[model samples]
Target: MLKIRNLVGGYTNTPIINGVDFEISKGEFFVLLGPNGSGKSTIFKLITGQLPCQKGEISINDKSLSSFSKLEKAKKVAVLSQEVQISFDYTVEEIISLGRFPHQKGLFKTLSVEDKEVIEEVMEITKVKQYRDTQFRMISGGEKQRVLLAKVLAQQPEVLLLDEPTNHLDIKHTFQMLDLLKEWQQTKGLTIFAILHDLNVAALYADRIALLHKGSFLDVGDVDTLRKESQLETVYEVKVNAQSHPTVPKPQLLMTPNHSKTKSELLNFDTSFSITKNDQFIHVQFESPLRTISNGVIGEGIQWLKHFCNFHVEKHYNGSNPKQDLQKWMEKYEIPFEQSVAMMTAVRLEDVVIVTKQIEDIKVIAVVTAGTGNAVDITNSSLSQSHEKVGTINSMVFIDAHFTDGALVNGFMSATEAKVKALHDLNVKDPETNTMATSTSTDALLLAVTQQGKETQYAGSGTVVGKVIGQTVYEATHKAVQKYFHRLQK
Candidate 1:
């Protein structure tokens, strides 16, 4: 319902918005994103007529913005600017009542029933009703933001312009404000055009995003279009990692500081292994935090951790939740949970196999500990419901090679595939299914890399790094399994 074409304007002779053209559809939540001084606020001022338009046309519903009178524009458009300061200490109710001025009849206008109802409804919606009678200055900045938002909603305009609406709000209030706006946009069909700095917020709430850079639109499309890591890196001139939201499909950008250092840089490589022994556990410490990818019960998924440990307990020691037990053990030992990644395994430390191979000026290390006491084949036709033992085949592959984020994920998958290939090669069978066992009932694999030497872009089976991983893991797992089978034969 709001459209700007070739919009060019600025404070002085220099144009801040140069030849920008875009349209905001009716009932659409559109966001304008940019770094500081990228002309986001300038565009808002041009649209609201606060600053004189140097060139181009801005229209609302086929009507020129210049054609509308002040009161008429107020009725159609509501604006919430960044700087919200009051000269006098006004009550929250009094501030919200001012929004009804555009709809009032005369100078000494009395509050109509409809106006009072709208004010109350808005206060309730914005969750500012608790402090409705409190002085606006007395409440916190976040509360004040919600109060002002209530005032804007009180205006009941067709289109709302928000400039950093969630600036002063905490996480709770931030979500509340955005949720209210989203609900209004959907139910009341209120078209919203907002300027936001938080990429995650924009990704979650905005139907479409327009990325502004240096007085022009750099990219304008749906969230996916503007969520590219490279696109964001170029526009913001900072390192950005785009990841999916935990429970949603929206993309979130994580900023990496320029001075940030990885584990490989901080840890000295004096010894290949750093092992710590205790009566109940064995801690395997690393020189530095390694980029790890695993599906283990503890510290699953991709992360960076310095230590990996195996918790040992007596044969009679039974814990219902292994993870909770391991966490308690970690707390008892004063281990930094954030810095360590641990797993539970029944196999003894002496039975673990460690192998290393040097290729292309880099070293790849593989470690494996296997047990076939309770192996189960997933492809078996007859399903077994036995929960007697949690047989584990823990495998780890480490390389002194650098990798991109994509390669880390690919490395884990390739290593897992290689492990399964090793199982098939060793002729391990699931007794119940009489089929080649693909994996143990409880198998966990970790892929750690020092991130040194040449950068490996992708670690699929075809890549050099992938080849080393496959060969090492295949050989190492074969030996580890054979050792376990030899114990069984004894």
Candidate 2:
């Protein structure tokens, strides 16, 4: 357990962590979060005694940090700061064994059986046992990070301090390492205090979160309370969209319109009937309405509903009968004309990490699907088929009247996140432990939208059920478009 009262510290005479107060219960995984220069790292420094404490007090297990001798603190608290520049090319086992030094008496201490067991256990948990004999410098940066973590674990301290532990890791390694840390915490009741840059990662593992900004504590509480978009925007001083993970209480972030990137970027939806912009850049506007439907063109579940605008309209099937021609194009382009699966995730225009060369002015739609299936049908699916490659998934759609293209290919993302996140938003522990549950459909539903046209473009695809979802939407949008276009004719 740890507590801080009116803590204040910083470099030189300037104060960074001013009047900060928070506490961590025993066995809690607490995280400090904030933008760069917000003093999260500085707070760690003050607590670790790396920098002299300017004001306030810090205590562990009701004992003042000031009162604990350096060696005593080493036994009680283990710190893994961001920087661990090694001067010697020590073997992985040698480095890990160093964590046991506090437990050893004066110099020339011999290894005890207990110490060797702890070292081996630490190596196994961190997955660096194989590298026990290898030099630390030979491994990749990410691997070395794991080694350092193992070393800290070998310390077997009561409290743990980690500074951006996952900064060097990729997505896969990040999860693996966190999994190790979590397992240790659960089994050993090791309390963690960390400063994390990635809010999503923090949300995934941290039991509680503290938000900081401009060298001040913006707020400190469980992730659910601080994950709201409004609070995030206020702290970041920018437009943002925050969503809680579906099954976890932690909040994820999506920065809005990359106003800094460029003003020329645009996204439109073509639903055959008409073309409408998904977002208009270069100014302030009201937030999007609570919901919008896509032609299942590009949408994630609980996905960004703003893109769903005006409803489905009837597509006059014209009976033009391009059956053979449509089939030919579908085959030629590797498009999935029938039931295809895809993933979609929506962030505000800004959060998107754009990669382009020509900057083709086009509309983008995201279609998504989320389902739990044990049925193994993997080998039979076509590997070449892709909606986006066929100029469909996450693309600009054209809307229409009396005729919907029903051709725009895409996947769903946001909606799936939102639906999954419902449990996460509750921020309740043991959500699944409640025995009784009710839900009939095992099928994953898709959401779509046509951006530019009125007729065929607005008409959707997939099963009869998929098309039925657009009924209400198409009906409303049909009227709205007819009235607008008809007015333009005048």
Candidate 3:
């Protein structure tokens, strides 16, 4: 429904969207991706009539965008900009109702049933109904964004133009809002043009991505075509690696680290327990050295576990002399004896899922205890049947080990394959069972699995197991616990 060819525009009367070209089909979710100053917002402005398109052709449904007047543009499409300022004291309903202004005839135009229904439906979809009568300024930034979304939805235009719409939003709200838009695009056939700075989100949602570098369209294609190991480095001037989202079958991108962040800039030290009768409770000791940042945040690195799980953190690390920087966090967080912990985080709550399953053929069972906590499993639990009910924790992580939070799959063959790979890489093995272990370091969320029952012994690092305890345990435990603790996040 939207098409741009050799499009060029920018704020300075200078070119920002240099020679960009692409076509988005009807109801497709299109995304514009680039660095902070790459002029993504300018492209949105030029298309929305806020700024003139200095060069190139912009069209909606084969008609030139430049042909539309201000009112005409509003009739054709809705634009939600990145930088918005709201100083009005109007109620949420009033603000969303304002979206209907363009469609109104005069000041006294009577509200139609259609308009009323549209307003109510938009409010409900955007979840601004609770604040429908509340003053717009009183809500949080995220809630206010939703209200604005309601206003845009109220516009009832055929297409959407959003710039960093998910900025400042929490994961839940981001997913909810985007999910609503996705539904609209599917059922209502609304075309979308969104400016996204997050590669992962872009990868997950966009139908096609236009990657921009210093004021230029470096590449344009679907998620797979746009995400590549080498080209991404050239566009962002940062290293990145691509991997498949095991479940979604999409091309997921992870930025590679320069490693120059610091000796402590990107670092993690984690230890797991044997989880034997002698040590039913695992003792985990983590040492994270901190490197100062313009902003205190960690980076996700693949070859390293940091990138996959987003365990990036900002903490104070004393190097000249080994001070207790890491110790203070361990003590401060009060990690339970068998609980998991996540480090360098500002707040903690429940977002953990415990999944258990049964693999009867192996004559073994597995229980995986995982949360958004700071615990990593070492081994042996891969063969045991019963999972643990250990407490929660938060900590800095080393991704070279197994996760307890929802990472295991259902089938034993694949799970065994992953385990064998991890064990081979870690050079660790089960003395009796002789099965290899699987390992990953991403910190997004975690799962910890413990196996109980049966005579299980580790044999070697490369041996493959026909039966899996981790899978069985994951199948058995996840759902009920997921529902009970989902609201822990504040």
Predicted candidate 3 versus true structure: per-residue lDDT over 1-490, tens digit per residue: 7888988887776676778778889989989898887777777787777888778998888999778887777877887765546777899899899888668776696667788898999998887898888987788888888888888888888889998998968999998988999999989999999998788888888888888778777788889965576888877888886778878978887675785444344323223222211111222332332111111122222211211111212222223422233334334445331223323321222332223222332332232222322222445454342112222222221122232112222222333343334335444333334544232221122222222222233312222222344333323223322432454443
Please write out the lDDT profile of model 2 over residues 354-466, one tens digit for every residue.
11111123233222111111111223332332211111112222221122223332122322323333223322122123221111012133343322222233322342222
TM-score of each: 0.91, 0.61, 0.58
Clash totals, every prediction? 0, 97, 66
**lDDT-better candidate, 1 vs 2:** 1
For model 3, the superposed segments whose C-alpha errors exceed 4 Å read 105-107, 260-490
| RMSD (CA, Å), each prediction | 2.7, 15.6, 16.0
Question: Residue-wise lDDT of candidate 1 within 32-83, one digit each (tens)?
Answer: 9999999999999998888999999999998998999999999999998767
Q: Which stretches in model 2 have alpha-carbon errors above 4 Å?
A: 105-107, 247-250, 260-333, 336-490
Query: Lowest summed lDDT over 10 consecutive residues: which window, candidate 3?
Result: 289-298
Clash number for candidate 3: 66
**Candidate 3 local accuracy as lDDT?**
0.56
The local lDDT score (0 to 100) that residue 206 gets in candidate 2 is 84
